[model samples]
Target: MSLIPSESMRPHQENVIGSTQLQFDQGSQPRLRVVTHTAKSILVRFGIVGLARQWPSSQRQATILRYHSVSSAGDYRSPTISVHPEMFRRQMEFLSRHYDVLTLDELVSGLETGSLPPKAVAITFDDGYKDNATEALPILARYNLPATFFVTSDAVLGKSAFWTGWLHRAVSSASEETLRKASDSLIGGMSSVLSREKIYAALASQVDHAHGSKRQQRFLALSRAFHHMPPLSSPSDFMMDIDDLRALLSAGMTIGAHTATHKVLAGLPEDDAREELSRSKQELEQALVTPIVHFAYPNGHVASNVDDAAIRLTREAGYRSGGTSRRGAALVGTPTHNLPRQGINDALGFSGFVFKLEEARFSLLLRGS
Candidate 1:
């Protein structure tokens, strides 16, 4: 009567049947009752399991992969944020095996019209790190993949107002105790167990204020108090120089502006915001000899801390599109003003990367349906 067999019955159905027959001989009526109940229970369990397995709820989604740098261990504080060149090659190889990789422009066009292909992915890099030229470009070329690099123009040209350089040095040079004291000094009696990761997040939250002259000066002073160590013998030792940018341009990668001094656009006055956006765009175009059409916010979050004026400024500055670190696939009809991209860290291995791509695609399918 039952559809599912017990574990004991799994190996030999004939043996279970033979044993039940033998038990029945000793007590006919009771044996019949037991068999009836057992069979009915198995039938119900089997039916439920079959129905659950047959139901359609295990499909995957699509997502884009965004990276910051692919560099040597010496250059990066977080290995997850910076994929090694070999790992980068492997990741791309895995992607090529399973998905259709799209260029930035193709993905943007598809998103504008709502016509993305199945299992499509786009790759992006941020910050224009020098190692991007030294490490990432060769690997990308091997796979014939095109990527967009968002450059903070002042940083690319070796200027010092960008907070990342100071932040990196602070994180690299300070002992755990010194970093703790610095955090306490800035935020006033905060806990001491804060890691560099947490400190970076806290500092990023306040970087929007760097657009204001007074606030910017205040932050610079605070950084000096906390992070300024003996200046590196050469400032260009840490960042990509102008010649490095030229090498990137020559390699067929597109460069997008990430603001002049990497200040959060929304936190600055309208005039200052305009200057950051316009000047960065103009500088990059002049350096690269091409129209720089895309932009990314310095910290990439505009929800709570950044103001709408920044977005307005970018549009007015003539950028064709901008990106944010929101986890979603680029879709047709997605606003050019607030395109969402997935921020990838090293923790996302080949399997994790594949799964995220599926997740983004699945969301798009659901939207279409």
Candidate 2:
């Protein structure tokens, strides 16, 4: 099932690996994406995947997997933020059996000590969904793996849905005509063929930076404008309550702050960004009775979601580490305040998931990490 090349092919193989790494690290143009995926497939076929996984340097690099919701809500859920319970269980089982699963604390400690185990991996969940408690916990417990849960204090405490969750529910339940109208209103026009993604993008663009009461006001206006749709479900249905977080803590998982209302800090004024970072840590510490040492920038995947000011403020607020949505495996000397994590979702099936773990590793290895 793996390619075994002769000695004559070694130089050519190195060339292939180098070129693929260059294309992957560059921008994701559609053509480059196709080429990169094809290159990955070719590498996997050539048994480079096995080499990447078993490479000794992999022991020195740690992969942190980021997740949002582990749920069975199916079509009622947003796939961008969820993995079905069964898929999640399988992924965890694979990690338990094949990977060296570490707690976030342990990963940080390893980075500090410059010694990480081979195949080191850490699991983390963001946005504090109720399913992280009711559904994801038992499976993780079954595998005896510890993960970090970065929670938005306001959503959990107020029992309100995260803005993305609210938008998902609205988009999921909206009729085509309603989507058309909302799209037209929000974006100043619309395509003839509307979609949930199109609508969600429109709404997210409108409110991703709105914070506090202003955020509520915008969402309320959206709801009022689309009043014909059925009322959205209770926030408890989407978000974890205080009890759920306590349950996570009781099960020996770590809690980290993800801002108070999940506002993108890089876009906010200095005072507002400070409040989002500091207040979340303070409130969650008070609520959970544990020092919140880690912070994940909301929408941290986007370059715009993180800035020098955001990183400076996170450190000034006393967070020991800050995780970003950036893709790559973290190695020793990777900055404590800007750890890059790969976002795992349902779209990456088990094979894709396995490949992702090594894809970045292969790139790093080629570049001599």
Candidate 3:
């Protein structure tokens, strides 16, 4: 028998006051009843009953999973952003077994038309890392799964930045003591009890300094002063090159713009934001010869410095969709331009990945709650 009415239901009255009563009057067996005199009790019961009626089904909603690097060794360091190559393969195997792996275009179209299939997922890689081509592509190809990449155009052509190369090196080389000292130097009067996690978070925040341009420079200066390190000859030391990008595109994978310089768009003036968005899209389109319709914010958090004006500008520039670092399922009817994606890092194994996907699906069913 149907548990809840098929149509969306609303309460008979708004601002319901006084002692409210609920009686499950329609049933073949003994019905349940609850009585509440307090408003909080009534509201709580109403929510519980409503949620009980709209519980998530075994059938899943469409989801898009995001990844950064795919490497076995380095992945362990950043468990939230990188996955080991073998683990990635296991994830693919699991998805193949249970879900229909859709391409980015297919997912976008499904979202537009409200015809997305159950248990559907799309895979995406961010930052255009070289390991993605060397490690991730082969695994995806073996599984016959199509994936999308959001590329930073400058990095593709070989530009070194302080953040990508220096910050990484700093964290990797610094003794725990050095990290604490560096943190104090950068953020003045910061706590000495900073853990490695807090240190990394502070470094990441600097990625938006100078509206994203000086991120590399800041890292280089800090690394040189603190660790006595020499500057890298090539900024692309930590990123994929143009050839790597082309190879991925040639292998039937998709590429989208991640901005020209990976700047946090919200911090810039409108003109600067427009330039960054438009230029990155133009550069990528010129390189790949494909319509660049997707964009990913450099840092997915909502920041006072990031310009929301840029997001609007991206839509105006003809992007069909964009991705955020937010954790949730991409609902079938959600706007393609502001979609949320779950990150697939080392912390998520085969089981954790499944749990996240299920969580996203359940969240979708409980929408408007």
- Candidate that scores best on TM-score: 2
lDDT of each: 0.62, 0.78, 0.67
Q: Which tens-of-lDDT digit does each residue in 9-120 have in candidate 2?
A: 3332333342453332332211112225556566667676657677767877899999998986743346776888899999899889878899888898899898889888
Which pairs of residues collide in model 3? 160-235, 161-216, 162-216, 163-216, 265-307, 266-305, 266-306, 266-307, 267-305, 267-306
lDDT of 3 by residue, 1-369 (tens): 222322233233111224432222222111122224243343334443324223443232477898998887651135457788889889888777767789899998988887777667899988877788999999988888899999888777665442454455556567766766777777663546765556666666765656544755665657654564445444655577878878888888889888887777776777888887899899788876788888887777464433457658779878888887766777667777777787777765454566456554432232322
Q: How do these models rank on lDDT, best leading?
A: 2, 3, 1
Residue 193 alpha-carbon offset, candidate 3, angstroms: 3.0
lDDT of 2 at 53: 74
Sorting all predicted structures by TM-score, with the top scorer first, yields 2, 3, 1
Of the two candidates 1 and 3, the one with more favorable TM-score, higher being better, is: 3
RMSD of 3: 9.0
